[model samples]
Target chain A: MNIGTRSFQFHTPAVIIDQHTIAGPLEKQGNLTAEIDQFIPDLYDDEKTYELCYTKLIRQTVNILMSRHPLTTYLFTGDLINQSTPTHYGLMETLLVPVTFDHACATFGLSLQSAAFMLQQGQKQTVMVGTMSHFAAVEKQFRFPNEYGQQKPPSSQTTVTGGGFCILATEGEGPKITYATLGRVINAGFKDPYNMGEAMAPACFDTLLCHFQDCQVTPADYDYIITGDLGAVGQAILFDLLVHEGYQVNREQLIDAGCEIFKDHQPVMSGGSGAGCLSLFLLSHGIKHLFKQSLKVLVIATGALHSPVALLQTPIIPTIAHLVVIES
Target chain B: MNNKLFHTVAEKHNPPRPLLKNCVMSFIFGGVICAFGQCISLFYLYFFDFSEETVGDPTVATLILITMLLTGFGVYDKIAQIAGAGTMVPVTGFGNAVIASAIEHKSEGYVLGVGGNIFKLAGSVILFGVFASFVIALIKLILT
Candidate 1:
């Protein structure tokens, strides 16, 4: 089936598949699943809610794809673990059989490259590449700056709860993956342990613009361009620079998943900084409608490549973004 | 005989100077500050027909302007000395200091001389507030 020619249909009112359902099947495999279960107890209601929300998003994507196409395998990009949490990785592994996880150096381009390599090796007919993130857990784990009495202006209220999934099926008559490119990662490697905004801004901009160049498309080529978690200030800076470059991208198209999911206008401090911000959006919103309508979509997921060592040393960490093109 | 002597001694005492002064000034200055805020609110309502919520903009602007003028006249320093934290804690105090300092050095170049030094004291405070919050967040992220 040609995804490009045929109209894509989406299942209405998405449902989250609970860990209990996935766990039951995984339990038959080995003790690793049990070890993962210990970290996340079903007792905490919020934990259950997070899992349920993400599960529902994943289930919706799978249901939609299975109904539309004749495919067996699916692929997930990177950052399956929101904050390197074992529970998150375990949950993600259950959904996609052949999963690839990489470190900060593996740009989005490299990660997607690896996913393509996995598909080639397995000779899978259809692959669903999806990602989910519950930033609430990551936020709770790492209290964001806004929680510490910083007054955030009212305009910072865009962060909303996020979850999204995209299925990449083998070249059929359906939607085609026109081009996938990853920008080079740039870091001044300066040490500014206190405010990451100063350090991250430069790295994020250089790589993001570079990815646009690699794709050989101006920012105006696509109807809409979506960025991962470049919080408020970063978003402002990126928009300013883009406008200066003669590309007029609407602020709405530059969606910051971290800010969107946050609900409250609380100073997300250095804005939204996490992997989950982008993943959740892609899983929940990125693919569903665009494929059905056959609208061209460009997705750029940005990440701050910081290790515990870099953070403690107060060094400005570098950032990288992966750009993917979906055409129907 | 002992009880009568003790009663006479007790009657001869006077109140502490600082304590009495503070109590008296608090009533006078506190009333003045509150009245100013009320007057600003009323003005906004009368001219703009602003609701209570809408009055905040004008009230804040008025307070800022009044504070700035007072700072220039050096009256705000006296108020601060008398009221201590009471004067500084309100939004008006911050507005006064910001504008007063900016205008005081207006003769200096805008970017380098005046603008650079205008936020000197306030800049540190804002930066401190921002950093303190970031640290607290870092701690929470680590421990959690």
Candidate 2:
């Protein structure tokens, strides 16, 4: 699927007609409060275990999306968990063929790109792309057990506890997914897991550059160029990089999902990260603009593909950023 | 192309780490925890009629109990979050680790959840700790 210069221009645009979002309490209080479909006070959505809580979040989101768009082909999903078992096990009731993707925080971008590309290729009439992330579960798996209460530096990001499920189809009246630029694994000797924002910022920059070069469009062309989970630290780095590269995009043009997930008063260190951080934010906030057809949005979802085990062994954090253009 | 692009952007941004600051924070955090334990030991030594050698067991037990209580009360985690690795170096840190494991698995149920998973992280610490001390003593005997 190497379309052109690491980008794909969909012949038949895949439209986002319906979507659902589930956010954590902290996120619910953020700017995107009104747009989020559901927000639980705590991670435990009446489930005994954190894993079950995470699974229930995904199941509930999918249930909502499925209800809205009953006529679908399959489901493309991912989460910040091992094997994506929570999503796999939770979607037992749905008859949609499930395909799980992993690119750390950029799972949603990968899923969305695949869905749109599939629809363009006429592989399936309609598909769902979703992503989920639970802070406790992710903290336990990637860094420390949540209760361990390990000290987090200002560079460290808080993993968002939420999920976003979206529906993409050829027959719809909404923001159309018109372009996609897949990222290549770029290793720049960034080994520290605590500084994940810096680790993925480079990838975000690279993917955005590639998309612009391929589509022959400038940053001003889109209403917002949203990057996934770069947090405050990475967001700063992105701005610096863009400036150094001679890209004169304003602050309004570049928005970060991770930085916006938490309120300014919240003590979330650098910002938010995880599979759901960007997806949930985009589904809730970006979708409204997309539906209005008044804005063309560019989403450059970034992800750190390194696992803790792999990170300890190597100093380089391989990162990816997938690009998707949503036109009104 | 990807490598070049990565190099360009990565070279522009180096992740910041306040190493000196972190080291100091951790030292103070750990130092404060030790100071607390010393105060507890002194309290017991002055109030009770225990010899220096005899005071070790009771002081350690009391310290563990107090820390376990703090962990249960949901105060220790907040302290640990601020203290960094300092909280984990002392006996109370081990106590915190054990309680954390217990709380994490509490949702799984009593038998399968709490009881079974209570030792997940602490089990290895105890196992290697006792074995290492025994090995050290054996080596000391041979050397002496």
DockQ numbers for every candidate? 0.01, 0.44
Q: What is the TM-score, restricted to chain A, for candidate 1?
A: 0.61
**Candidate 1 per-residue lDDT over residues A96-155, each given as its tens digit:** 454544433123334444444444455665555544334433333233211111222322
Look at candidate 2 and tell me the lDDT of residue A239.
84
The C-alpha lDDT values of all candidates are 0.48, 0.82
- Highest TM-score model number: 2
Question: Residue-wise lDDT of candidate 2 within A22-120, one digit each (tens)?
Answer: 988878777788888888888777887789889899888888878877877589888878899889878988877788987888888889998987898
For candidate 2, give the lDDT of residue A316. 71
RMSD to native for every prediction?
A: 23.6, 3.2
List runs of model 1 lying over 4 Å from the truth.
Answer: A1-43, A46-98, A102-113, A116-122, A140-162, A171-175, A188-201, A245-253, A259-273, A290-292, B1-144
Task: For model 2, name the residue pairs that clash.
Answer: none
Please state the interface RMSD for every predicted structure, separated by commas.
26.9, 2.8
* Chain A TM per prediction: 0.61, 0.96
